[model samples]
Target: DIAHQNKREIYNLLMRASADAVIRIAADPKHLGARVGVTSVLHTWGSAMTHHPHVHMIVPGGGLSEDGTKWIACRKNFFLSVRVLSRLYRRLILDGLSRLHKAGKLRFFGDHAKLADLAVFDAFLQPLRKIDWVVYAKEPFAGPKAVLAYLSRYTHRVAISNSRLIRVDDRGVTFRVKDYRITGPGRHTTMTLKTDEFIRRFLIHVLPKGQHRIRHYGFFGNGNRTANIARIRELLGAETPVPGLAHDNTIEDADAPARVLALPCPCCGGRLIIVDTFAPAQHPRAPPASARAAA
Candidate 1:
């Protein structure tokens, strides 16, 4: 239950981290009073392709002044220091989680059941302090075009691509998992998993109903997005996308299920047989075969 709870939306913790990040980044006088525009994309993948949830924030290093008069930009390559961001992020997340526990908003189950007691909860969260929760920063995508390319690959991706699955049979399914195998001379390897187990592992990542897995915060808050965009435009004093400059890329991979067969369908734990699959580029609106559309 704790695992489920942890994976589900922790809105308060998310917001707290966002706020702290914006505060730290914006408070620096070196920004020369530039505004901030950031879109935080929630991602839950590590090198192992496991459910290590984290955020990939797309931010313009600098923004227009609040008055929409001058454009500002950060240094060419650096965003805030990852070390600082990690420390701040962990603290803010923990503090918010603690607040939720105190307010009786957090639910505990399994071995976590004892967390109902304040002392027990404190002890449980204590170890979190010792472990440095991972915070990584890839060099910002090149320019607007590069940023778009990067997002195209991740934004709508499902738990696992159908191409990764070799086959699904009654004798435990078999599917390919990423082989982070190093290349030395002619050495290469790919990992595979059994079907039932694959579905089980994939199911672990299925988010709850109506949970906005990816969200934006700070100056990029949805409510203020339009006005903010206009403000930013004015600050930049840069011409908008040239008339013919506007272009789009659309790719259609062979239809396949974005998830592996290992995860069971919530409705009956039935195997989610692939009727079709769509690539990240062409994310078609569709419902999960295993469950009703989340309201």
Candidate 2:
């Protein structure tokens, strides 16, 4: 799985696009010398958790100035423009794919045999050029707390949440379907599937082990994240972050992260210690179960 060059190449191209896009944006006088971090997480599923591959990126609002002199604060209400970002992202990725095709690095499958031909490939991409690629940019979180809570969900994740797999009946397996509209975005609505189909759909999201779907990039590149972050703060003329602020941006900054896990306790901004938890069978047992009882 990881041995496939196409997957690796595609992954690289996506990373490059994010980095390049940031560079393009930074080059603009508006952005100054933005030293923003980009963290991209690979997700190969759609609302039904089907094999609809895409990446999610987390990005800070501003970056270091070009000269690393001042922090280039982004507009309070926005990140890069979704329309423009999408166009740039799509062009970079499609161009990479086209290059691979021309270099004989990409392969056409059984029915895609025509794609093996350069002319056919060119024709195939013709429509893509006309289509506005799906680059969505949701409003940045309300506050820093929201950002941390959001990152926790994707910093690590699984293909399916337990609440979704309702049952494994003959008629089909039952799970939740999310009506992003009605549920007011990132909310789940229920749906079902045949047992086999359920497995198939779920399997599509299974990443090859060791191939990390979650990744960090740019100022958060790990090598000199501290320095880059410092440069960014300097550029924006901001105070050194006290703590819990997001300097880590991502590959898929378009959509918001899924909120499967709980957020830090709002009542107490400080750490909320978890004393213990009960097992499924023992959960909510008796009239009033206590933490000690579960232990």
Candidate 3:
């Protein structure tokens, strides 16, 4: 359990590394050689409420050219090659794990105790290099609204939504799950698990304290996003029908309120404003040093 507890860190590292790899590949002179933007959201559960960590990234169909004077559009119905992305993603994650292991940042216990040994750890990671990892990319959304709607569904989701829950009686917990193996209506099925097992599975998906499940990268990064985006807009030309394009405003900029108000309020169709700020609750203390070392 202690070893598995750091999965949130692993997930974050994997996604960030994979995104960097994608950007590097996409920016290759032979490929696109343009600056791209990506918004990645981490999902840690499957329909069966199992620990199935993955990232959903939204990337524009094109990017700004390296010269910052032109826009580069990708080929129709295609982005980066998934096969290349998968291979790179696998390597990055495995290498990251190896580094963590060597740094004594990773813990091991119970069935995974052998991984504490350097030889065993190396052996454990060796097999991963041979297998293909999944790194998928879909076609661009219809519009900015479509992208926002899609993000809203996943950005805040938990292991299992209330709508999927059928019952939680003394015997166990029941929920509806989509059996992707079958097609159409037949894929929908109900599953029941012992109460303890259900809770255990759900708890595994709970992220580490203060961990951000959503992250932006490349041109979308917080530091230079404003300037980079403004250049992209200029390259695309004012006549282009890019939805939701507006003036750039850095967090330090005085025009930050204008940026905040740009988002429409869902309740009354007015504007969202930051009326107050508060510090986050303190996280519970970790296991004792001796307890952790024992694991």
Candidate 4:
């Protein structure tokens, strides 16, 4: 509830702090005074449908020079150093939180009500400065289509998807969950919870009304994005291509074979043919085709 109430400020701080870190790092003379752009999306749920807030930032591999005369590209397989990013992000966020607390812009209730006291709030944030905050960066997308696909999957997703729901009855709601602790076939499992409990979990993701989850920064920001992009493309000596789907099919084809390997029995190392498909809330029982097939 507190998170939902303060969603706007939290999201804004996250976006600003992260973008500032990138901009500061890129502007260093060693990086050739490059100006980078970032697009960030706020995600508030984990894989098991729990409240875990994080931001996913999509950044171009490099940036244009400060004078907009040359393009500065990052070295192969690396963006900014994660260590540097993490330290800067941690400091920036903690500082912002402190200022907000001092200004009485933050609200605290329930167990955190004690944080309303200035001293307690300062103490609470003091330890955070010594800890390393997580700031992850992934490999660049294959093309614009991959970027589109990623945005589609992540931007507006709720806590749980309809396909994962198995059943809803008086007893509870059952759903399939991926147990990430175990690898391979053993990872899939089912969990059931009361209807009210299910709703409670889902509602944890409800953002504050009118809060914008997607934000753009640097050259992609709203203020002068048009002029900035034009300058960048001109510097790179390339015009913006027509907006269309990426023609590369190799990215999609790479994952196609996983379906064929799905039915392997982990214990017996044998194939398990589907005898019957179970409806929602019911688990499928597929016996191995050959008993004791493994040596």
Q: What is the C-alpha local distance difference test score of each model?
A: 0.64, 0.67, 0.78, 0.78
How do the residues 133-183 of candidate 1 rate in per-residue lDDT, one tens digit apiece?
Answer: 666667767677677666656676676776665666666655454444656
Q: Give the per-residue lDDT of model 4 (tens digit) for 166-195.
A: 898889999988876799987998989888
Tell me how far the alpha carbon of residue 7 in candidate 3 is from the true structure, in angstroms, after superposition: 2.2
Stretches > 4 Å off in candidate 3: 1-3, 238-295
Question: Model 2, range 36-74, lDDT digits (tens) per residue?
Answer: 678787766677875555677878777665566665667
lDDT of 4 at 138: 87
Compare the candidates by TM-score and give the number of the best one: 3
Q: Against the correct fold, how does model 4 do in TM-score?
A: 0.77
Name the lDDT value of residue 245 in candidate 4: 33
Give lDDT for model 2: 0.67
User: By TM-score, highest first, what's the ranking?
Assistant: 3, 4, 2, 1
Compute each candidate's TM-score over C-alphas.
0.71, 0.72, 0.78, 0.77
Residue 229, model 1: lDDT of: 72
By lDDT, is 2 or 4 better? 4
Q: Where is model 1 poorest over a 10-residue stretch in terms of lDDT? A: 243-252
Segments in model 2 whose C-alpha atoms lie over 4 Å from true places: 1-6, 30-33, 181-188, 233-295
